[model samples]
Target: MSSARRHILIALDMHSATDAGLSTLVSIARRLDATLSGLYIEDSQLMSAAGLPFSTEINYLSAEERILDPEELLRINRLASAQARHLLEELSARDKLECTFAVESGKVAIQSLSIQGCDVFLPGRSRKSLTRKQVTLQLRQLVLIYENSGIFERMLEVARLLAANGMVSDITIVSETPLPAEITGKLSIEDVRWHFQAVSSTRPEQLRALRLNSASLVLMPKDLLTNLTERQWFELLEQLPFPLLLMD
Candidate 1:
């Protein structure tokens, strides 16, 4: 619902992979003719640990343990945030992606939910999974979970651009309900298809069976997540085997 126009969000962090992925992000943006946005999340865990009286840091260069107070953490966060924003500015400039940027403070997963008004979400990296089985994300398919038929056209339009990104093999819609007539009227895809997964009538399980995909990008509507607690969603973002995107 952001615009009749399309928008895509790309996340950034202190990691090098984040900057490395900007070209890929811009490629998708250009293909969709979508505006772009970047969100740099301040790590809440590091901040919390910094505030503890017993907090300490190990000097990676010196191999020494040192005090890591809140002040130091804040300083580190400022530098990291600035670097992230700079990268966003530089890479988004490679194309006319109509890019914008922002910064937020919280647990990364929790903080990312604050980003709004976008069509697709791309996490810049395949972050560590809590499951710890060393799973890899497959970016060859884009999975979308939509709320209603009204958003169907927007979904497919975004899907088309994403699928041609050299990695995505196709688009898949995981639906609990039948397609509304308006959507079905215009829907056709050579590779894109809808897969049915049953859910509790009152509470749909849109995120279910998602872990089966090895290295895919899974997208969902931000407003349609009715069955999960914030913590549950945060954990899902952290532990999912693939890159997860949530649209607003």
Candidate 2:
């Protein structure tokens, strides 16, 4: 089994979108025989902002301005964090997954620093409906999105890991141009399959189109991701609703 453990930082709040993606985390953990850890951020900013004496929000349901208080915010954070821990324990234990969870009190993005040593992980949630069969993505849809060979080897390494765990059915290498044969031939993970496709001219638009339903996991070079601003990152995420593995 591959020792490349995948850390999936997710919110377990019943009302949060991450709660729905919890199943995907379990599936990946079980398949990879990896440790599945969860982190729930007790956002301090929300509490801090609400603590302002004049802070108010028009409650969408009631259309009434609601005053905020520090005491009540603390109470809500405690309750939410507790619920998240309980849910994580129950679900993870049910699957016999080696799971651990932590609560960080800060911005959602900054909390990810806890897993900085990880080689790869799901940094956000994917709304793509996950099924038991697709846990390891048996759909044979593994897409590596990139522009060059600088990180092609790393992409193939991750793909091999997926194959080792039987998390991949087939792999698709999507690039701006065709990759050299010597590089393509190196993607030989036993009993695994893959193919490559290069777009003619446009890249971003074509890439978005391919991401819609072309793959279950989009593997990308971590450095390449820097090309996107935070907003663009989430926008691309919305397009590719499936899990994304950003690797070094």
TM-score per prediction, in order, is 0.68, 0.65
Q: Tens-digit lDDT track for model 2 on 97-186?
A: 777777767644344533554434442344444554444344357787855655567667667766887667678877777677787668
Candidate 2 lowest-lDDT run of ten: 11-20
Model 2 pairs whose backbones collide: 140-169, 140-170
Query: What's model 2's lDDT at 150?
Result: 58
Report lDDT (Cα) of residue 219, candidate 2. Answer: 72
Cα lDDT of candidate 2 equals 0.59
Clashing residue pair totals per candidate (backbone < 3 A): 6, 2
